[model samples]
Target chain A: MKILVCISNVPDTTTKVKFTDNNTKFDANGVQWVINPWDELALTRALELKDNAANGITAVSVIHVGNASSEPTIRKALAIGADDAYRVNAEPTDAYNVAGQISEIVKSEKFDIVFCGIESSDFNGSTVGSMVAEFLDYPSVSAVSGLNIENGQTVITREIDGGKEVVSVPAPFVAIVQKGIAKEPRIAAMRGIMQARTKAIKVSEPVAIDSLTEIVTFELPQPRAKCKMVDAENPKQLIELLMNEAKVI
Target chain B: MSVLVFTENWDGKFKKSSFELASYATKVAEMLGTTATAVSIGNVDDSELKSLGNYGVKKVMCVKNDSLNVHDSQTYTKVIAEAAQKEGAKVIIIANNNTGKALAPRLSVRLKAAIGSGVNKLPLSVNPFVVVKRAYSGNAYAQVALKSDIKIITLAQNSFELIETPNDAAVEAFAPSIDASMVKTQLKDVQKQSGKILITDAEIVVSGGRGMKSADNWAPLSELANLLGAATACSRPVSDEGWRPHDEHTGQTGKIIAPNLYIAIGISGATQHIAGVSSSKFIVAINSDKDAPIFEAAQYGIVGDAAKVLPQLVEAVKELKGK
Candidate 1:
């Protein structure tokens, strides 16, 4: 069985967000890029499943819907141990367009399972995975925290309102995973990084599609007011402030 | 022609989020000179359905499908899309919760609608259908313009206020055709976390971090949480170090919550951690380092060791509650 993990190139979690072009576009200047944290975890889980020969997972491949500038992120996925990678040559305009591009790749690849992070840290749209499943007419399980192949059947654990539910899904499905899919993302070993330079990163042109939504502008949240400090010795004063001043208690 | 809101019921009872969605949809409908209709799936009774009227819903479509007792995104999408078609709903609103997160994108595809996920406000313009939502985590906001004829919006929880506008809404039964093949996944078991409040649903959260010192120090934090009826959370490092469960981790990579009151104890407020929680209506920080970044985002702060202050705070809460 082959697994395809969809990864996105996003600004590092610590990078201060800025807007350009009158706040219509994200400023990418001097921003560090990394594989989306969730996608990295998904890829790590896929690789772990592949590591165990008993799981019958033959190969794990990574795919991204981005321009050439994101190839470094894609190569980083390769270093983390994907067999190969696919980079759709297009700017990820919106969730719909990105999902359509991914669906095109899934149609040709015929992977048994596809993984997408629940949401990217940038757009936080949380739409692409299920949209891809809808486009492919495949079953999708979201909020997946645990995925295991038991007796050749895929067992999935998803978090719901109060608790969690475990389910079994048939193959060729989408798993929209969140945290706990893997203990932690694996760091690429030196040898793996060396080998990643030689691995094949197939570039495919994006399928023609129009984004359903457009970004009108970007605005930063208003700066927070200076914090009102209460002395540690007078902890009760803090409580009174919460009740009377903040009225949040 | 009308605004449709998908209200999710837990064991046949609607939560605050459902009512908030109803209220939001009503306001949006008012903006567009139309009425708001709500669609409920699962075992909600007529009286319970009519209660949505308290939030300005004029009509409710109740779909009592046994197959949909548990959420299957595919079937739920199909059922909601059919309801939207029947109502000629130009705008569809859903809560940006787990169910909505899973269902909205598929509905967007099925209904050929543009989705504005996690939208925090009403349409900036009704003609163009633009909505504002948090982007780049909570560090920035984006105004999204929907170009499609039909628009689907996932309302961020706690972002909108629930206005009680009683209208005595009419509850009508809705039966959408469900294909058996749509049930692809078999639910084997369910495990509900009991007793403790879920952070996502909690109005207030009391979170700890590495500065809490050790797992043993969580008792006072838990006591404060219990006193205030708040959920307990931890920073990513605390969870990573196994001092707290991964489920309790709240950061950019963990749960993104917007509670009414977030009391962050000992958390230095990394950019990522702040990203997850900056949506909180009010933040109170307690840390030894006065210069911790958390104080910058907090409304109120105490510059002291969490160990020295936590017990006192807990006692103060108990006294305030007359315990």
Candidate 2:
């Protein structure tokens, strides 16, 4: 079975977000870039399936829809055990454009299964995976926590609001995955890092799809009020503040 | 052109958020100088769909199919797209909840419409159609512009108030051309059962992170939640380590919650976790680390061990409530 994992480059969780160009663009000056946490989990899960010889998994390839600047982030994914890489050169202006690019590529390179993090950390749109499935005319599942595929058929478990829902589908489908798919993401080893340095990153021209949305401006969240520290010894003071000052009780 | 609202119903009952979304959509319709229409999907009763008139819906369209009882994002997308086309809708508003997350993107692509998902408020300017959205895990905000004539906006939960202006909304059955191949997926099994309030609806939430130290230490947090009539949640690590149930996990990959009061115990407040709860009306953090990131977002904080502090906090709340 061949697997495809979609990767996104996002600012580290600790980075302080700022907007430049008169508050109209994401300022990437001092921000540290890393693979999105959700995508990392997706890649790790694919590797685990490959390691265990699940479904005769032969190869795991990675894809990213961004310009050459995202090469480092793609390299990190390759280091995590992706067999090949493709960087669709584009700005990824919106989820629709991103899905269109992937779908265009999928028509040429057919894979048995496709995996992507449920949402991107930067935009948190949570729509790209399903849109890709629609563009490819493939059945897709969202926020799948557990997955099992066998002989061209798949059964997946996903979380509903209050409980879990288990569903069955045929192969050649998309699964947007989250936490329970893998306990811990695998770290790159020395040998894998060396291999990734020489791995060929194929840059494919982006297919033009009209982007419907744009970020016109950006603003930081309003500064939170300073914390009112309560004496640990006098625990009742905390309750009093919640009652009188905050009035949440 | 009219404004179309997708008023979703869960199970057999309508969610309060759906009503709030309907009201929000009505306001958007007023902003656009048009009428607000609603489409009710799933196993909802016709009476409940009509009740949206109380939320300012003027006309309601009912889409019924035995196969639609289970939520299929693809089919729902087709249904909503057809409804929007039938009504000549210029603006389509949906709930930015789980269902919206699933259906909105596909609909956006299908209709070739620009979308503003997870919008915090009404349009800032309707001419170009700009809306404010949460960015970078709620630490920042972004103004989005949708240039398309047909626009879709998914309003954030708890951000918009549910306003009632009874108009006796009329319900009519509408059929969208659908083929057997259109329904590509089906729900094999569903295990939804709720005893306590769902986190999305809870006014108060007591969330524990890895600082709780062990799975056994969760009792105090649960006890405190019980005392205050709140739900229990946890950080990603707590759930990842199998210390807490996965459903209780609240973070970036987990549930994004916006309760009235959110209390964090033992959580260090990673950006991922904070993104989910930052929109909460009030925040209080109880952690031994005085410099934990939770304190930055919290209005009140205590530097004490969660195990030692949870019980006392519970007792104090009970006493204050005269329970």
Candidate 3:
């Protein structure tokens, strides 16, 4: 079985996001780039499935749609135990185009399982995995928390509106995974780092697609109103404020 | 041409966010000097479909079929794309929820329309349309430009209040091209939450985090939630440690929610977690650490041990509500 995991390079969660070029582009200065946390979670799950001997997984590959600047991010995925890497050198203009490009590679390659983050951290589109599934005309499940692969069938458990839904599908389906896919993402060991340096990163041209939405300007949310801090020692006062003042209770 | 709103309906009624989108679409339509039409799918009752009139939609077009019952992005995109073509809609609206997350991107690709997800405010200028959207979780906003003639928007929950405009809405039956091949995957079974209100639909939420100490300690917080008729949620760490159900995890990668009142207990307010509830109308944080980042987003805060604070607050609420 072969697994394909898609990763997005995004600014670290701690970074203060700012837009430049008259708010048309993201300001990259002093921003620390890292593997999108959501995608890293997916990668962790993909690696776990690949490592389990019973799954009979052969290759676990990571794919990205970004230009040269994202190479380091792809290498990081390789260090995290991806067998190989592929970069569709292009800007992910929008979720539609991103899904379109991913469908191109997934169709050409015969991977048994395709995994992507539920959404990219930067745009938070939450659209690519399902869109790619639609583009590929493949069975797709979104926001799955638990996955088990056995006997050529993958069973996924996803949280629904009120409860859990369990669905089983054969190989060759797209899974858009969210947090808790793995407890903790595995960090690269020195040995793994050395191995990743030699692993091949195949850079491929992107499928042609037009971007739909464009950023016109960027602004900060209105500053939060000053918080009313009450005496923690007095819980009765807290309750009073919640009722008569806040009207929450 | 009309402003088309895709109400991702379920059993019989439209979801809360989709209902909000329907109301938003009507207001937008009135501004653009056109009518608002709501497009929906699944097994829906005639009266339930007609109730959209209360939200100001002029017409409702519903596609009924068993095969389209399950959440299929491909089929949903096809269904909505067909509706957009039929109505000659220039602006399409949807909710930035699970259904919209799956359908909008594929629909945009199918219709070659400009797509904006997490949209909040109305269009600033009509000539070159610009819509406000949240970014970096919820710390900032960006004005997105829709360059295409067919502009699609997925509005964030709580962004627009669903006020009754009162219109005599008409329901029309629609049947999109659905083949057997459309059912790519089958849902074996669903164990949905019953009896209790879901956090996604709750107006008030009381959430606990690692500060709650353990799963057993969730009792007091749960009591407070029950007293207020609110839903319960947890921070990522609490869910990761099995202190809470995965469905109750509210964070960037988990569930993004926007209730009227979000009471966060024991959470330090991580950036990703804040993104989930930042759109909330009011936030109240309780933590032992005064410097917890959650206080920044919270409208009210209490620096104390949740174990001590929760019971007292619960007692106070019980007294106020005269329970």
Candidate 4:
């Protein structure tokens, strides 16, 4: 079985987010970049499925919808054991455009399943997966916590408000993995890092989309008020403070 | 110029966030000098739908259908898009829950509107169309401008303050012309994990991390959760160990929740873990490491051992409840 994992380059979660130049765009200076945490789950799950395949999964390929600046991220995905990588040579301006490009790629590759994070840590929109699925006319499930592949069908467990739902879909579906499905993302080993450089990195152009979502400005959240500490060894005092001072109760 | 809200319901009961989103939509409608109407689908009774009027809704369009109860995304999108068009709603609001997150994008395509998810604040500019949205998974804020004639926005769970004032309104039963093809995917079964309340709807949540020592000790935490009528969650490490189901994992990778009271025990708040629970109204942290990053996020913190704190907190809750 062939799998396509979509990865996005996002600012590391630890970065203190800020905006510059009248807050029109995110400030790029002094920011460390990493593959989105949820995307790492998708990638790792893709690898696991490949390793556990009975008929022998051919390869796991990583794809990113971004410009040349995102090469390192695509390379990192390869180093983490993707057999090859593809970088769409375009800046992702909107989720529709991103999905359009992936749909075009999906048309050619005919991958058995596509994997993506529930949402990018940066955009946090959680749209691209479903959009891609809709564009391809394939079944899609989001926030999958458990996955099982058997008898040419995949069973996935997802959460709703009061309970859980376990759904099954045939192969050639799309799954957006959330966190908690896998342990810490495996780090690229020395041998895998060396092998990644030799793997093929394909580039593709984005398809045309007339409409797009726009970002007007980006800003840091208002600083939280300073924490008010209470005296320890006195539970009643803390309760009093919560009732009288904070007035939350 | 009317505003539309999708009332989230599960098993024929409206979720609290639905009323909260309706309250928010009411304000947005008032800001635009128009009325807000709600569109809901489920097996909900009309009398229950009438209660939505108290949230300042002028009317409630109840789409009572059995297929709607399971939250079929494709069918929902078709129905909601038609409702928006029929009502001539310029702005649509929905809770940023799992269903809303799945439906908003599809509705955007059908309505030809620019969509924004995880919206936290009111529009900065209504004319040019800007709303502040949570970025970097709530670590930062971004103002998104939807340069379109129609707009759809998903309000972040627990972001807006809810208000209550009575309004005399009518509940109108509306039937949507849903295509059979839209209901292509069928729900086989719903397998819910048995434990505390579902995290998204919980008023109080008690979460732990790797510091709980072993999975066997989870009983006390569950006991405390039951006492408070709270939900039980875990950091990534606990879920990784299979001590808890991944669905109950609250962190950057798991479900993002915003309960009224979040009591985190033995967990050092990693940025990833905090990403999911940052919107909780009040946070209480209990950890041995005083300098754990979780302290930075908590409103009230206790420096102690979980082994000692768990039973004590359970007892405290039980005493308070007289149970």
| TM-score of each predicted structure versus truth | 0.98, 0.95, 0.95, 0.91
Candidate 3 Cα outliers beyond 4 Å, as residue runs: A169-171, A244-249
Clashes of each: 0, 0, 3, 1
For model 1, the superposed segments whose C-alpha errors exceed 4 Å read none
Number of the candidate with higher DockQ, 2 or 3: 2
lDDT of 3 by residue, B148-253 (tens): 8898888888778887888789999998888757766667778765688888889899999999988999889989999999999999988889888878889887
- Among these predictions, the greatest TM-score belongs to 1
DockQ preference between candidates 3 and 4, better one: 3
DockQ of each: 0.87, 0.69, 0.65, 0.51
The lDDT, on a scale of 0 to 1, for candidate 1 is 0.93
Error of 3 at B80 (Å): 1.8
lDDT per residue (tens digit) for residues A16-77 in model 1 = 99988999989999999999999999999999999999999999999999889899999899
Q: Candidate 2 chain A — worst ten consecutive residues by lDDT sum?
A: A146-155
The C-alpha RMSD in Å for every predicted model, in order, reads 1.1, 1.9, 2.1, 2.7
Strongest candidate by DockQ: 1
lDDT of 2 by residue, B1-323 (tens): 99999988777678888888888988999999998999987667878888899999999999888767666667788899999999999999988877787778788888888888888788998998998888787778888899898998988888888899899899999878875566666567888776877888788999999889999988878888888889999998888898988888998878888888999999999888998899999999999999899999999999999888888987897888787
Instruction: Give, for candidate 4 chain A, the lowest lDDT window spanning 10 residues.
Output: A230-239
For B1-323, candidate 4 gives per-residue lDDT tens digits of 69999997766788678888889999889888899999988778877787788888989998877666555666788789888988999999988888887778777766667888888778887888888887888787777888778888998877777777678767888889975555645567886555446787787888988889888989999887887677889998888788877667888777788787888888999998888888888888888887898888888877878887677666655655476
List candidate 2 segments past 4 Å from native: none
Range of the 10 consecutive residues with the lowest summed lDDT in candidate 2 chain B: B178-187
Clashing pairs in 1: none
